[model samples]
Target: MNKRTNYKQEKRMKELEKQKKKEAKKERKLNKERMETDGGEIAGQEEMA
Candidate 1:
């Protein structure tokens, strides 16, 4: 019973990690699009700073 609970916890952790990664990827894609539309210049300036 203890082992089974541990296994479930591990699985839950992996699922949470996957969800976090997915959200991060989505955020990055959106940021990229916004930067492109606003102008790559903004990103370039940020890099310089």
Candidate 2:
């Protein structure tokens, strides 16, 4: 019984880590897009003006 519970706990920890990594990747992509849009547009607009 102890072994089985430990196995389940380890599996859960792995799955949680995987999920956290996926979320971090998604957040990075989102931040990249935001930075690109926010940073580039100001310079582009200034150039236009």
Candidate 3:
């Protein structure tokens, strides 16, 4: 019984870690896209000036 519980606990921890990693990756992708758009707008403004 103890061994089964330990295995389940470890599995849950691993799943949580995986979920956190996926969220972080998604956030980074969004930030990168935002940066690209913001940079392009800034460049365009500078050119107009």
Candidate 4:
């Protein structure tokens, strides 16, 4: 029974980790897109100045 509980806990922890990683990846992708768009505008303004 103890070993089974431990196995379940480990499985749960792994699932949580996977979810965290997926969220982090999605956030990074959004940030990268935001930066690209914002950075392009800033660079264009600088060039004009």
Candidate 5:
């Protein structure tokens, strides 16, 4: 019983790690896109000025 519980805990931790990594990757991509668009907007404003 102890071994089985330990195995399950290990498996669950691996799954959690994978989920967190995926979420972090998505967040990073979103931030990158926002940064890119912000730069574009600034350039556009500068050109208008």
Candidate 6:
């Protein structure tokens, strides 16, 4: 019983992590586009980070 619960919890954690990564990627892409539209300096700062 405990083992099953642990497995489910781990799976849930992994899914959450994956979702967060996807959202972050989308945000970065949007930021990059916005930066390009504005100026190259912001994009360069993103690369540095």
What are the TM-scores, per candidate, against the unseen true structure? 0.70, 0.80, 0.87, 0.76, 0.87, 0.69
Clashing pairs for predicted structure model 5, backbone only: none
Q: 1-49 in candidate 5: lDDT tens per residue? A: 3546588888999999999999999999999999999999999999999
Q: Candidate 5: worst 10 consecutive residues by lDDT?
A: 1-10
Model 4 poorest 10 in a row by lDDT: 1-10
What candidate 6 gets wrong by more than 4 Å, as runs, is: 1-5, 40-49
For candidate 1, lDDT tens digit of each residue in 1-49?
3546588888999999999999999999999999787787777789999
Q: Model 4 residue 37 lDDT? A: 100
Scanning candidate 1 in windows of ten residues, the lowest lDDT window is 1-10
lDDT of 4 by residue, 1-49 (tens): 3546588888999999999999999999999999999999999999999
Compose the digit string of candidate 6's lDDT tens values, residues 1-49.
Answer: 3546588888999999999999999999999998787788777789999
Query: Following a full C-alpha superposition, what root-mean-square deviation does model 3 have from the true structure?
Result: 2.8
Model 1, residue pairs in steric clash: none
Higher-lDDT candidate of 2 and 3: 3
Query: Which pairs of residues have clashing backbones in candidate 3?
Result: none
Q: Which ten residues in a row have the lowest lDDT in candidate 2?
A: 1-10
| Error in Å for residue 26 of model 3 | 0.2
Q: Regarding lDDT, does 1 or 2 come out ahead?
A: 2
Model 5 TM-score is: 0.87
Residue-by-residue lDDT tens digits, candidate 3, 1-49: 3546588888999999999999999999999999999999999999999
Clashing pairs in 2: none
C-alpha lDDT score of every prediction, in listed order: 0.89, 0.94, 0.95, 0.95, 0.95, 0.89
Instruction: Please tell me which model should have the higher lDDT, number 5 or number 6.
Output: 5
Runs in model 1 with CA error above 4 Å?
1-5, 40-49
Write down the TM-score for model 3: 0.87
* RMSD, one per candidate, in order: 6.6, 3.0, 2.8, 2.8, 3.0, 8.3
